[model samples]
Target: MTTPVTIVGAGLGGLVLSRVLHLHGIPSTVYEAESSPSARTQGGLLDIRDYNGQPALETAGLTEEFRKLILEGRQAMRLLDRDGNVLLDVPDDGTGGNPEVERGELRQMLLDSL
Candidate 1:
């Protein structure tokens, strides 16, 4: 008999793992402290890139869905001083592998996939 996979915390990592496992016909149970997705604020944006995050999404077969969530021009770099002065600003040339998307949206997409 195969041992079941139990993933703690329904955050990005756990959710991705669950989705990937599901795609490969593996079963996994995810445990999250929150009562529901809206129980707490999902918080902030995420930068998914070719090197790290994007690869994981691809493994889970979410590349197309992930692309739909990409927020253009979010990879632009900006450096700020203590006084809120902009030291450097660089626009996203569209080649910067990383693209930003809302964390909640990504989480929801993974959930829906499962």
Candidate 2:
């Protein structure tokens, strides 16, 4: 029989770990200090890279759900000078392997998946 796992937090890492373990028929319990998922506001944008976070989500079987939370046009970057001159401009051509997603939304998605 597989022993149950205990996770200390509900952050991305912990949630993802729980998810992956669950996928393989393992049981896990996540313990978070927060009273609830919405206990407080989470951070802002997170760049989920193809090499790391994307594969983790895929292993959790939440790639489609994660894709839905991606904010379009966020991959674009820009830089302006003091004189309001554009120093750099990078458009979001939808080719970036790293997509920006709201931290809170991602957390909620992971929580819901479990």
Maximum-TM-score candidate: 2
Error of 1 at 101 (Å): 0.6
Candidate 2's displacement at residue 45, Å, is 1.1
The stretch of ten residues in a row with the least summed lDDT in candidate 1 is 1-10
Candidates' TM-scores?
0.84, 0.91
> How accurate locally is residue 92 in candidate 1, as Cα lDDT from 0 to 100?
89
Q: Poorest 10 consecutive residues of model 2 by lDDT?
A: 105-114
Give the per-residue lDDT digits (tens) of candidate 1, residues 1-114: 556799999999999999988888888999998999989889899888789999999999999999999998888889999999999999988888889999999999998998
What digit string (tens of lDDT, one per residue) describes model 2 on residues 1-114? 999999999999999999999999999999999999988999999999999999999999999999999999999999999999999999999899999999999999999988
Candidate that scores best on lDDT: 2
Candidate 2 regions with alpha-carbon error over 4 angstroms:
none
Superposed Cα RMSD, model 2: 1.3
TM-score of 1: 0.84
Cα displacement (Å) at residue 85, model 2? 3.4
